[model samples]
Target chain A: MRALRLYLVQRVTAAIMAPLVFLHLGLILYAVQGGLSAGEILSRTQGSFFWAFIYGLFVLCASFHVSIGLTNILQEWTSLKRIAAANIAHTFGMGVMILGFRAVYAVVF
Target chain B: MTTTHKVSIWRGGAEGDYAHYDVPARESQTVLDVVTYVQRHLDPTLTYRFACRVGMCGSCAMTVNGVPRWTCRTHVSKVTGGGELKIGPLANMPVIKDLACDMTEFFEKWQKAQSRFIPTKTRKNPMEPIKPDTPARVAANAGIECINCGVCYAACDTVRWNADYLGPAALNRAWTLANDERDGGWADRLKAVSDHGGCHSCRSHQSCEAHCPNQLNPAASIAGLKRLSTSAYLKGELK
Candidate 1:
């Protein structure tokens, strides 16, 4: 892909992830402060399709964000360019997505 | 009481060190004069670059006290104020010799950014009439005076960090060309600048603007390229 497209994707994904990150952090703080148990958290999350969808979108956006950032870092620091570096970044993002989705599924469904 | 100002000049190649010299101070002495004194009287073998002895030619640029500046135009009193002065080759470039850097990469990136003016009409055709009051003409005129001295390129941190990144001078050239209504290469030029190592790599540190001897704002030029490239992408012209 051309760099402009990559640049756009990175920016768009970052925008999507920003609010999601804040929401996730807020949820963690709220659950811990409220002394909510795993069972209580599960009871609140498991039956809600809204929670599943939001978390799913979060996982995708986070994956793209992390991967694009890593790709930029690797390209700047090393001699890697174009396809090889991008492929490595995509593999890393895929790994993040797989793990992230699995964890979200365990919590949501 | 010291009668002479202590000057440290970088000698030799990348692995070398700074050699100290005491230069006799004078009223309104320029950095180039100090370098000339050191070369002619102190060290016969010292190497540097200069031409015109004035600011017209942009050949004699070097690092003076950590800032890239034209040696010809920068006065000793203005920079050092009757104190010690450190002079070296420009930053973010390979030092070829004492106080001289190879500008191959600098010019190469100019080519990469497609900075050349692409004329749409053949020489046989009549000259295209362009009104100077047009916004595009005025914008093109704003940045057309760059003499390619490489000072802005040396001052750019992005170039130092990312080897492939096109520095300020090239981007500024591209911006001027992009604004030229007579230039028939906007599509290709925009594509070139939108590449991985192009205008998007700039972090807007503004070092290029800060160090420009001509007072030209390469940061603004790069910003213009960013806006143009983003719009082109939105319009599907950059796909």
Candidate 2:
């Protein structure tokens, strides 16, 4: 893929993640301040598809965002290029998505 | 002003040490003057490069006090800290000798950016009339005066980190050509600069703009390239 396309992808994912990260942080604050117990948190999030969807999208965007940003960093710091760089970035993205989705599933179910 | 000043200069290629020399300081003296004094009086074997002894040629650039500058224009008083100076070749490049860096990569990047203007018409056709006041022409005019001094390239942290990155000089030249309305090479030029180590690699650190002797803003040019690439991609014009 062209670097322009990758640049766009990274920026788009960052844009998507920014608001989601803030909202998630706000939710954490709310939950802690409300003295919500583990049971209460579970009860609130277990069946809520809305929270699941938001977290899922967050995970997906963050995965792509981090991988792409790290790939750029690797290119700058090291001599990694072409297929090697792309493959490492893609592998990182896949790992993050898988781990994040599993965590989301554990929380939502 | 001191009658003599301590000057530490890099004395070897690739791997070397700073050799100290006492140079006679004079009124209205440039840094190049001090280097010349060392080579002429103290060390006959000291190697350096300069031409025209004026700012127009851009051949006398070197690191003065850890900052890349036109040595012919930089005065000893301005750069001397505590009665000492450290002069060396430009950073982010292979040092060919004392105070001279290899410009092969710098020129290579310019070629890779494909910065030459491609005329759309043959000589038989009428000359194209370009309005100087147009926004594109004005933007092009603003960045077109670069003499390839390599100061910006030396000052760039991106170039320090990424060897493949097309430094500010090449990208600035590319921006000028990209804005040329009569140039027929936009598609290929745009594609060339949109690749890895190209315009997208710029972090907008502004070091290039800050250190440029001509005061040209390469960060702005790279931004223009980014905007152009985005627009070209959206419009299906980029190949």
Candidate 3:
């Protein structure tokens, strides 16, 4: 069933994000060893394929996870039906992915 | 000195109101005893349901001061430190009268989860030998004592939120069957539980575990089903 597939996708995205979140936090601490300078942060991330891929994957997973969570919340809380909730969540996910990847591109490119 | 405590009980249907009475609280008097006193001495029209006076049958479950519990086992002195008792029907179901909830939907969800055991062998065959300590049997043994009391159903937020969700008890029954080695139908059962409104809907609130009088962990059983669903999804076994 589609519900089963989506549930699995939600779980997998959560699993993917767990370690990435820790890594991102660790990066924050490591980067802030000096003052919180945008230039230094961008200098470290700029033109780095590793940083690009890591943040890119993090953004993708977050987009997927948050969308499914929103779908569940909308179904439970709002008057919207299942299909309507999924549609809204999908659009929301697209927005998240677009904004997130744009930020990733700005930092990595 | 005999102390009379205030007892408030819900009367009528979904549009019900709590009726108050003064009941003499006795030493080791169960909540069921309080209800019995109200019915026998105070109000003859007050309605409730119970089977065993002792704790065996779970028919006496009610919301005692907001917590779902088996009234037969819950003593007034243990629960009522404030010297007050508030009793009502089990939640998340249609109240038949006062303390009784219609269990039709509760059992219907059990059927919806495909909880029936599929026999691999008929009566003509000898009994299949299943070892006691095996992992499957151990897992099956963990959740087999459910008495269909519907307490966990009353406590579940997922069941309250998702109309389609097969609540804790049904999925717990499915888990026991899934671990049954002799059952040749777990494949179908697996797919059934993996479908929409099945095991995937549980949010791991553990309210079922917290409220179950039988000490069964439907939450753990649901987690097991989720793991199976994930493995099956990855293997392309479930589509």
Candidate 4:
């Protein structure tokens, strides 16, 4: 049952990440080629609810995607069993979320 | 002139190592030839399995140089480099003896995956004619030539990772039934294959398609199952 859940989660996260990744890439290209400074970018993005939400969702999807892939890799290559692999995956996802949320808070607030 | 080729054949069960033997190589010689020569001349006790020396029987399959291949048609020139060959039993299976793995689990998973076709009509009733060019029939025909060689099953990584995951051949067989126009239990079969260790478990690695002796594409069949399962899930047909 847990395996099923992980499989479904991976699929759902991949779906979400598809558009988020494109949007993120577009924004980076726009900002870098347009020669926008860090302060200028912050001024436009600072405390914006839309930017916060988009980046937050992006971070969440990325964390889920990376952790699930890493869990499978560990299971295949390392000595970790399913239970230990799940624990490690959850820890990695939580750490990414915490760090991501901190960035969102610093930029938006 | 009789030419000798150095062959290293696996000599025991699961825990065994490769044992080297020099055998006579000939024109159009095959990997099975090497094994047969070693067993017949060098050691009568050496064991392996083969029926038809041709590729039709699908009985003579083993890992030749880290790849699953039909031993009957796989010529020595195609596999051997520097006149050396390393033969072993198929992977992802328990070897019962030298070059022969126990295939009970392999075939049992076919049953578990419900690979058999379920009939919708009795023989006493009128016969139903199925159109050959219909979409379902065409899809079924695309992957129905599998001969149960166990090569794809041995080469699959998903089967190695999740023992319960139905290997490519069984799942491919299920895909054929899923597209059968005469079969009536597609809903049940789809649900059965949509479980944790079912069609969704396939990682789309394409190893089965790569190693299939008949050159059939089981990976595409698996993708078809995923599409069917997703549509079924949306329609509330799958729990």
Record all residue pairs in model 4 with backbone atoms less than 3 Å apart, i.e. clashing: none
Q: Rate the local accuracy (lDDT) of all candidates.
A: 0.89, 0.89, 0.91, 0.86
Model 3 CAPRI rating? medium
State TM-scores per candidate.
0.87, 0.92, 0.96, 0.93
lDDT of 3 by residue, B1-239 (tens): 88887999999988889999999868888999999999999999988889987767778899999999999998888888966899999998999998988989999989988898889899999988899999989999999998888899999998889988999999999999989988888888888899889999999999999989989999999999998888888898887
RMSD of each: 2.9, 2.1, 1.4, 1.9
Docking class of 4: acceptable
The parts of candidate 1 lying over 4 Å away from their true place are A21-43, A79-88, B81-83, B122-129
Q: In angstroms, give how far residue A76 of model 2 lies from its true place.
A: 2.4
lDDT for each residue of candidate 2 in B8-68, tens digit (9 for 90 to 100): 9999999998999988778888999999999999998898889988888889899998999
Residue ranges of candidate 3 with Cα displaced over 4 Å: none
> For all candidates listed, what's the TM-score of chain B alone?
0.96, 0.96, 0.96, 0.96
Candidate 3 residue B152 Cα shift, in angstroms, is 0.6
Off by over 4 Å in 4: A1-6, A34-36
Task: Give one digit per residue, the lDDT tens place, for model 2 in A17-106.
Answer: 889989989999988886979897888789899999999999999888888887877777778875677689879989999999998998
Top candidate when judged by DockQ against the true structure:
3
| Among all candidates shown, the one with the greatest TM-score | 3
Once model 4 is optimally superposed onto the true structure by TM-score, how far is the C-alpha of residue B194 displaced, in angstroms? 1.2
Where does candidate 2 stray beyond 4 Å?
A: A79-82, B122-127
DockQ for every model, please: 0.45, 0.59, 0.76, 0.43
- What ordering of candidates by DockQ runs from best to worst? 3, 2, 1, 4
What is candidate 4's CA lDDT for residue B175? 95
